[model samples]
Target: MIDLDKVAHDYGGGALLSDITLRLEPGSFHFLTGPSGAGKTTFLKLCYAELVPTAGTVRLFGRDLREMRRDDVANTRRRIGVVHQDCQFLDHLTIAENVALPLAVSDRDPGAQADNLSELLDWVGLSAQARARPPELSGGERQRAALARAVMMDPEIVLADEPTGNVDWEMSLRLLQLLVELNRMGKSIVIATHDLNLIRAAKAQIAARVLRIKDRHLQLAGADL
Candidate 1:
């Protein structure tokens, strides 16, 4: 659903991603792996139109990103869900309210989706902590709550950065299973992480392609993954 053609991004000083041509197809699952500061996060940002490439074209849903206006970009983002590395959330809001923030920010009436929010919390195993605030929840709870929030609007694509970085193996697999289930239901997924074991666990359950960013280039990871 997203296409990058010879995409290269420069952060003023130099290019972070060079000659990166990739396509995220419908109903496909991908794992992005790289060392720290290797531009894994940058690649995810490019996918969701958060950062426009400096040297190439990025197309979302067959439309060129460069042609999209401010409102166009905002609307396009609604179709894509993002789970940030920090799990950005309003500290004042409870877990349920935080999960419903997507719907609230969209033009929709948040109250109308109360049932959906509850179901999502249950699905993510955060039902008990719905009344808890972001600061009060554990790392795993926060991450799962973040996932629930990301998908609250029923986005077509889910882009997650270091989603399991702060959690244990059991929680990591739980989150992975949630993503896998979304893929099974036809939502395209791209997860940027350094977790090799998590990638292997996901591979055992589904055919997931692993992409590694090394030497400022994106390539298919070796069989070791």
Candidate 2:
């Protein structure tokens, strides 16, 4: 669904990522691991067209990102869901409303799909907390809610950045299982995380390829991982 060829990105400094080529095929699962400031987040941004690469080409679906218009980029992004490190939500909005924000902003009526929203909350074990505000939720609850929101549109691909960063081990496992379920349902999944233990744990439950960033390049993680 995402294709990059010799992709390189820079932000006024030297290149953050360079000579990276990757193809994220449909229904494939991948774990992206690297130390801090290793451009894992920047790589994810390129996948979804949030940032245009300084060099080379990034293709979303079949079209080159640089060739897509603003509306085209926006429409294309609807097919890709992103779970940011910070689960930013409007505190005034209820959990259900927050989760349905994607539909709302896309000119779709959230109330029209109320049943699906309910089921999604239930799937994330947030049915009872649907009426609560963001601040009222615990770390795990917030993360789960973020997951629910990310998949609100049934996106074809899900990119999660440090999804378990703020949660406990038990909660991290819970989130991993939820992501695994998404993968089973045929969603392409890329989780950018630094937690090796979490990657090891996921390897036992799913056929996932681990990719590591080193010296501005992407490489397949060795069996030692």
List the candidates' TM-scores in order: 0.97, 0.97
Best by lDDT: 2
lDDT of 2 by residue, 1-225 (tens): 899999999998899999999999999999999999999999999998989999999999999999999999988988998988888788999999999988888867777787889999999999999999999999999989999999998899999999999999999999999999999999999999999999999999999999999999999999998
Q: lDDT tens digits, residues 1-225, model 1? A: 899999999899899999999999989999999999999999989888889999899999888999999888988888999999899999999999999988988898877887999999999999999999999998988999999998999999999999999999999999999999999999999999999999999999999999999999999999988
After superposition on all C-alphas, the RMSD of every candidate to the true structure, in Å, is 1.1, 1.0
Q: Rate the local accuracy (lDDT) of all candidates.
A: 0.93, 0.94
Lowest-sum lDDT 10-residue window in model 2: 107-116
Model 1, C-alpha of 9: deviation from truth (Å): 0.5
lDDT of 1 at 45: 91
